[model samples]
Target: MTMVTPGSSPSPDPDLVQTILLSLRRKQGTWVAWAQGCQTLQQAKLTPQQIFEETGFEPIQQNQIVVAEQVYQSILKAGLSDKAQAHFDQRGSDLLYELRVLSQADRARVAEFTLKHGLEADEVRELVKPVKEYSYRKENPPGFGDGPGDAIAFHFWKLARQKDDLQDRSRLIAQGLRFADSDGARQQIETLLTDFTVVKEQPAPTLPLYRLETETDLPRIIPVVGQMPLTIDDLKAVPVAVPENPFGMVTFSGTGAWIAVPGWQVIFQSEDPVGLLTRARQLPNYPAEAADEPVLVIVDRANREWQDDGYFLVAQAEQLTMHWSPSPIDAPILGKVVLILRPKRILDEDYNRQPWQLDE
Candidate 1:
């Protein structure tokens, strides 16, 4: 390892700079040597900025080369087959760079795998994630071998199990089958594909969006005894307050703000329903604009019993909040969150067309 001192050109050699610059320009099939050339220039007290000015190699590229070169060297020292060495000898710098995240031993194994599979740079990048994360998992996936291929297979197998759609699950299972090293792992994934059944998922209930109007039709409060005649200003002097409505209303402002929820759908088997007002952040998958807007979470107060597939409103810190658990909670269960009314985001065509309008 040569020590790099910034701006300390002890002995300036113009020929050496030109030679390295030309080699860097010849960017075909010699990135390993290019990395070494960059190091030589750095050792000669040249900064990465200076190298960039001379050779047009950016600072980030230089960093990738330096780190990747070290990883390549470690792979070489660990030893690879003659064919693997020959393949990596020319090109594959991007492929080797992606392997830097793995351990030295794992890097060697994956380097050979990359060579065997003829993997592209992007494929190598995807392959490194599972290999790097495999060690951190508490337990190894059953029926999978302890190889890089098995690691990839296990990764896809878990994802295949998590998917609800048959198409998505089948695609992931096929991916896992492609990388399954052991027959046991292959059989396990194949079983999922062979025994697949299409169970139609029930559609979620939709509710209409309503605005909370500020104006009220309630009668005005008057003093028990006042002046015989009162002026409009005198009446206006008294503060006005509207009584809270029995049903909650979630409001949204601005044009093109309509969620295309169909007719109101009945929820649960409750006779009476109560509504609570809260922000959209409490719910998952809310739109960015709707994050701050109020939402009416309708629930049945009578249905306080815990249901496996239901969301409940619970009291926490002396405040009402959602309880997302199957089992009973220590806090008081307010009700089941039956219908959530979210405002729709409908862009106005006229407003969107303004950006493309020609100047007058």
Candidate 2:
């Protein structure tokens, strides 16, 4: 086996180095004997002489030897011998051998070791104070009645919902509502109510609409279809005019409003009839693929803030089908008005659910 040279940037095995250092630190007597008997001290070719000269230290002085011996004795007295032995047994012995070769730096290393492992009286107090404070907080949680019991229940409910447990979701909602009724939980209750209403009211469309090109050889005129409920199959069968070049041409209404092209699919119907009509006038294209079922179309009458005031029938159409036939101007479509009314019983039920008047 080749002898490994020290301090030569050799690929030292970390585990071997740890093991050696640990072993050397543990067996103080063995380490001292090895240091005294080191025949290869000169061959180690260390910077000890240069360091000693720079520091102006007399290497053979009796006082220096006494100081070194006292420092080692102090480390031994601090029970470092047993601790170092344990570290060596657990790690390795090469590290201790390396430490022994560093004569001047060994004193600093010993001082560091003592500081790390040996706690002063003040250090012990510093460690205990925070732990005591934490214990107090645990015993007394913030807020009044039952001390964080409801908060704990809410946390558990939330954790349960994350696990996709429907039962836990319902439980949490119920618990949260109850907590809201409590004097201390009113603010949290109001926040939850706002979130529920916002989520429920926001409508997300499944199909996207596209823009229609006017000048392209593709069909420029799309038939203004009726509000009649037509399935996707019916739409597919409806003949459309296709342009030749199919490029750069955009479709627009007489009033400068951009009409949705015939190709896009209709994904959702607005509950507001006026909003639907406004949306229809603005769409330029439709979705290509849609479900085969006809969706409900409401003639939105509530929000009419435009100069072109009229009813709009919204539906999904293919994105590439250029020409629309049987225009909205036909005689049969002009004379009819479709009204969808809510049932009287349903209206009455909603009315009954309303909050009581101030007088009552």
Q: What is the C-alpha lDDT of each candidate?
A: 0.67, 0.32
Q: Once superposed on the true structure, which residue ranges of model 2 sit more than 4 Å away at CA?
A: 1-171, 174-218, 222-255, 258-360
Tens-place lDDT per residue, model 2, 193-294, is 334332221222222223222323122456444467977776766445433222212333344322222231222233333111222222222343432222
Go through the candidates in order and give the clash count of each: 2, 51
Each prediction's Cα RMSD? 17.0, 32.6
Best by TM-score: 1
lDDT agreement of model 1 with the native? 0.67
Worst 10 residues of 2 by lDDT: 316-325
Candidate 2, TM-score vs. the true structure?
0.15
Q: After superposition, which runs of candidate 1 have C-alpha atoms over 4 Å from their true positions?
A: 1-18, 26-29, 195-360
TM-score against native, each model: 0.50, 0.15
